[model samples]
Target: MGTGYEPLEVLKPVADDIWIVDGPEIRFYGMPFSTRMTVVRLSGGGLWIHSPIKLSLALKARIAALGQVKALIAPSVIHYAYLTDWKHAFPEAEAWIAPGVERRAERHGIPLEFDHYLAGANPDWAADFDWLVVRGSKTVAEAVFHHRASRTLILTDLIENFEKDKKPWWMWPILRATGIAAPNGSMPRDMRMTFRGNEDLLREDIERMIDWDPKRVIVAHGRWFEDNGAAELKRAFGWLLDG
Candidate 1:
């Protein structure tokens, strides 16, 4: 089994105004996997939490010291479990929903309502981000955000960079089978299946992302691209781009 990995750690800085908190390890399909939450400090001095993780009192205080939690977002359906916790803690924060998120949450027995649906541009944070709804997936849709100030692209599950050495021994086969078990950080094959016939639509979105020209990409699972982020992104999504 994977050992030597820490869980529920403190928030660490990834870049200017960007912090991440590592969360507990959990199992999916009998494989050990971990989760993480990303926090971005907005220009208004408020905070925008992306795909929030489990909240501890210590972590909560740490975040409070940073700024008011202004926006609590569920980047996608599967990433919303901790939304309620943060909402209760920061009731004043807007709980924004991504495209097709409401229905997915409802179907999954997760009761949550979106205060605002993410559309064209958000007046509050629009100046700082470029938002897109990743289409072509039959079962799921993810809202991707690119932070202009930090030159960082934030995604919940589009691409996973799993460190094979950090994962349990039993998970190797499954992770490899999914095409997400390290060596190279790329979109998982299972998620690719969700795209199915939506190749063109998905490609269009990727093309738009390329225009942003980000310097880093943060993902919810596994590892994030720290340098040459745009190049890595193009490389990872080559399947659609090449065509």
Candidate 2:
């Protein structure tokens, strides 16, 4: 999948102990779309997986190779589609849920035995790192993570990365209208419309993320910036702030 700017393939290690799996190919649906799942190795050898899309036997084997699957983190309610598969593969690993995921899980008949729920501005589980929930977005309670050491920002549906020229015809008008289109090609309009009435919270939350002075920004649907990440974030969220 495109991170809305540059296109990449498979899981690429952008930082030490952090790997990003770009999505855009709905391998099952046979449709082109942008999606991503990030895998991280915690300081203590536990592994954390965020926004995982597909968990095939081969992928699971690969993940097992990285480290023991200590936890499966669903960054948003909508991102839990593959949780069952991942859980089946790693039954011993606990499932961590964001806010409002239980209802969605039940509706989809997806068992959510969430061992932890991210509450308030600071969560105890988050040691040495910080995150915030974009309060106003109707899509889902999206918990964005900012890793201090790597200067990385991990996101879910909050931001998208897809190039207009690269998108199918039906997606163009949607991308242009929402102001997600960037000269760099990430966060096309498909995701911009989802930000309705949540601009202030998003801007505030993102400002908090930037205060950490991140050097890299990893978007689920787009490319990850290796350099000048804060600038890229400012550019990405500028419209929401200005509006």
Candidate 3:
């Protein structure tokens, strides 16, 4: 029911104005996958929430104490499950989704609306974050972010570092086979195949992320890097970058 990162829905500060919440696990392709969310209080005092999890009254109260939720971001197509609930809670918060998310939601009959499509750095929160849509993946174009203030790189499925001990025995082979096991996780192999002809584009984007020189990296699933962010980026992405 819960991932190793307990104390769900409570804000865990990562840096000034930035915090992360570890949420309950959700099933993906019949496998239980852990979920996490990132919250950032913008300079103007509005909250930016990334990949919201199942909402609760207690969580809502905690968020209200910080600031008004202004932006709810669906960083990838598959990460929009809780957007509708979050939208109902913070109607004023603009919902931003990646390119293919709208269609994915529609197919699943999830009635969700969005105010902006996350392409490049939009003027709305550009002052605080640097972002990019990881090009070359025809199936999943995840929008990755770098918080300028905290020097933290925020990613979704791009890099999953699942700890073996935290996962069930049945998931060990799957994790190792997909190369998403902790201490050495990279992009999943199947996802990598989607970029068959466009490795260069992905490499370019990874290069830019490495250039940002993040201090830490926060991922939606699994263990995130707490320090040496750039080196971790290089190491995690070595499979493609080295080729």
Candidate closest to the true structure, highest lDDT: 3
How well does candidate 1 score on lDDT at residue 102? 80
Model 1 is weakest, by summed lDDT over 10 consecutive residues, at 1-10
TM-score of each candidate?
Answer: 0.93, 0.82, 0.97
Model 1 clashing residue pairs (backbone)? 2-168
lDDT of 2 at 63: 82
lDDT of 3 by residue, 21-85 (tens): 98888889998898999999998779999999899999999998988999999988889989989
Q: Which one is best on TM-score?
A: 3
| lDDT on C-alpha atoms for all candidate structures | 0.81, 0.70, 0.90
lDDT of model 3, residue 120: 51
Ranking by lDDT: 3, 1, 2
Tens digits of per-residue lDDT for model 1, 176-243: 87767665767888889889888999999988998999999888778778878889889888877997
lDDT of 1 at 32: 63
* CA RMSD of all predictions: 1.8, 3.7, 1.1
Q: Name the regions of candidate 1 deviating beyond 4 angstroms.
A: 1-7
lDDT of 1: 0.81
Candidate 3: list runs displaced more than 4 Å.
none
lDDT (tens digit, per residue) of candidate 2 on 1-243: 343433333557878888886654663234366677888888776787888767666677778878898877887876877776777788888777788788888987877665666655344347736677767666667888887778788886566655666677776665556554435544445455566766677678778877878898877664456788888878777766566
Q: What ranking of all candidate models by TM-score puts the best one first? A: 3, 1, 2
